[model samples]
Target: MAANMFVVRQTKGTVLCCKCGILMAPNPANMCVTCLRSEVDITEGLRKHATIMHCPECDSYLQPPRTWLKAQLESKELLTYCVKRLETDLIKVRLVNAEFIWTEPHSKRIKVKLKVQKEVLNGAILEQSYVVEYVLQDHMCESCTRFQANPDQWVASVQLRQRVSHRRTFFYLEQLILKHDAAVHAIKIKQMDQGIDFFFANKSHASKFVEFLDKVAPTKRRESKQLVSHDPKNNSYNYKYTFSVEISPICREDLIVCLLELLLVWGISDRL
Candidate 1:
């Protein structure tokens, strides 16, 4: 009984490798781990060629096809972007090291050497290095496309009109907006009679601007919307919003004058 059990164990435990013709323990691939790895490539899904979205006008790469809030002009970011685009569906790929092989800005061809790692069996990782060639294709982003088509197009407008016509007040407001980056979404700024107009492609941006103004200056605001266009098939409504913001004319310097004038003329001032 013991001799028969030993034979059964040997038959089940070992396999003849088809490539090397070596007798070894059977693994998931019906061959030894070493032979299986050698015969089959671990980087089968990894790509050798890639195409990156490049906008010549903006000199920016299209990442995820949206407005990138953060700056991605660094070499590491650009390299990673190309690698991700090439190996779209590859899983468990860790970048060990990356080196630029050749970069031709004129031809728009960038070759990079990427040393990547992947897990195989029993948590054992395999590292392989490959030279990936990236071809930068001219693809216009949404913002650039819109600007190229028309420069003066906007979706919403912030009509800030104060009671007094003072350019100093508008200058102060511009400084605040620039310091806090409150108008990051504003595509264009147009100087109006008493105040500056902030134009945005999104209504939420106009709403954010209004919120920022409320914190800085106590203002009375009235909003109105006009139907620009509507798509019945897509069930989408496109409307242009106008935010008329009127800040209090009584500033700190004019506070006493306003109160005294109001009390003298209109019986009594509520603030006083």
Candidate 2:
């Protein structure tokens, strides 16, 4: 019985499975070796679809190699599957401007007219006229820096129009502002009849600021809204929401500098 037990133990210890670090059962060959090789092959096959190359010069679109495209498709499929299983919620992110306009209409008949003269790119003359009504009251101009309370300090009839919308419009405006601020290194704010105007030390900076406004402002919506009441006796009221962004001169200067630097770097890198 002792000799039979010794032989049994020797036979069991002779064939060890290399892959799983286990003693092989009664088999003709090593069990772990074949299994380990198969596992490696499977891993390699899975990884074969993950290789891709991106352009280093410009971060724009380039023709993708076939293998890279296949890898991207496979990765996208896996990501979609995982995301569906996880039931993720999609987030909607929108950029809005911080400034807006408020207007009040008057029933008092006062004749006010505005004449805007602009020159087109083709040297064509453009002019427009609009009637404005305002209650002219004697008050000091809040934006004037004159020491004496001159009679010329009266708040003139002015129509306030916000130059930008509450969206990506301001983002570009912020960029143009930054460029001018950096170039001039100083900014000044003047309260204008329309709203508020920004002035840079350099005249070109001011021009650029105006151009930026013109480019972005045209995209704003000019639709007016009417408030309707259910009561038959009451009349519906019309209201409009105008968008504008306002910042203190000091704060605006600082922001312009920072934004310009950041955007300059981003723009350069993006086009590289």
Candidate 3:
């Protein structure tokens, strides 16, 4: 019996790039690694035609919310949001800059300049420029719609009152509310001779307002609820809540000292 065998050889090979005649190894086509990666248009996945949700009456744009409360986003923030929506998983994105171009007057369409740096294969950064178009579509938010249709469609209200009419205290309270972003929850704020009234679309917000006031100043509070609507089929009932808060009168300069002798006479001392 006889057997035959042959030697097999392996060799390293290099290919020229299809576009640019550069040497690259392990390339599927005759293209260099750099040129091959650059050929993949990341902008293809980018959304060219986009619609920005905007309210013409309020002049506010729909923004991604950080909280549960309804809020409007600024122009720059909205632009960032649009970019995120346009980006795809093909490349890693780092937004360089964005600008809105005023092409013409009375035009509903807006031209936006987006400069982004994308990281492709081998950690190579590719800079991409795109002029994205966004059509300003008129869309009304829930809060704005409620404001327009029924101005007084609030479910709860807080009546803040002080025995002495002091604008300074009320002014301080207003400043605090504005700082805490609590005022955004209120549908309306009404001024009265005794104090101010804050109307809220939800009872939770009204209760939050009362808690905020209590933390700042010691107050006596009274609550009342009235049945507003009933759904018989669903077995649900809706009630309007009213909270009356009476803040204790106190000034920065005022102080009171209690004597030990008085406590002894009243038998309120711990030793007694």
Candidate 4:
């Protein structure tokens, strides 16, 4: 026979509520859940409504002090975005749970379900559920403002011409441009009789675009530059270039490549 031993269990002592006189665990208030909820509210002073800056052109929201971020609906990114906006409002309380509440279709409004916990009555913690609403206000983003503010800021251009008298081939070019997103760097795009014109603020971008067209279709390229300004003191010359691209039915290396370039002045410097 083997020797056997018995052990005693240690448990925390329980107490009774002062108001309702019911058995409960120890707490700062020594009260029940129902009584504490009825007495104090942790959702006090929480904002019920707020306005958010939204850019309709870009589908992005402003995060104050000149920061723009993208957040899709019903996502954690949006939840964090909402919480960040409420940092000042939540100074007194702490967030326990935050989530997006579905809004009416096509309303462009957002509602967030919130749960906050706060310590009160000297160490007693209380959690409460509430909701906050966000009203979207239309605000144009900086990039959109730049294009709208200065339509004539393009510095270089590529004029694409294809000598086709009949059926649409430039239409095919449009599809190709859309597929490759090659026009993202262009400041402006205009449709012409022979073909299309792509405008850019940077001459290098024009060269890149001409390269793209050459790769996608049988084409020849030419480059030309005209003197714009001469700084005699600095011994520098500024020249504007124009690029003319001819789209051919067949590749011919003998055809001369043409380029046209123009210059426009702007305040911001292009880091690229």
- Residue-wise C-alpha lDDT for candidate 1, range 142-174, written one tens digit per residue: 766796699756788999877774555566777
Clashes in candidate 1: how many?
0
After superposing candidate 2, which stretches have Cα over 4 Å from the reference?
1-168, 179-186, 190-196, 201-205, 215-272
Q: Can you list the residue pairs that collide in candidate 1?
A: none
Q: How accurate locally is residue 149 in candidate 3, as Cα lDDT from 0 to 100?
A: 99
**lDDT for position 59 in model 1:** 66
lDDT of 2 at 202: 37
Candidate 1 overall lDDT versus native: 0.74
Residues 159-229, model 3: lDDT tens digits = 99987745666777778876786667777788888898988888988998899888887799999999988
The CA root-mean-square deviation of candidate 1, after full C-alpha superposition on the true structure, stands at: 12.6
Q: What C-alpha lDDT, on a 0 to 100 scale, does residue 72 get in candidate 2?
A: 23
Q: Assess each prediction's global lDDT (C-alpha) against the native.
A: 0.74, 0.34, 0.71, 0.79
Score residue 31 of candidate 3 by CA lDDT. 57
What TM value does model 2 have? 0.17
Clashes of each: 0, 5, 0, 13
Q: Which stretch of 10 consecutive residues in model 3 shows the poorest summed lDDT?
A: 65-74
TM-score for each prediction? 0.45, 0.17, 0.55, 0.57
Cα-based lDDT at residue 263, candidate 1: 92
Best by TM-score: 4
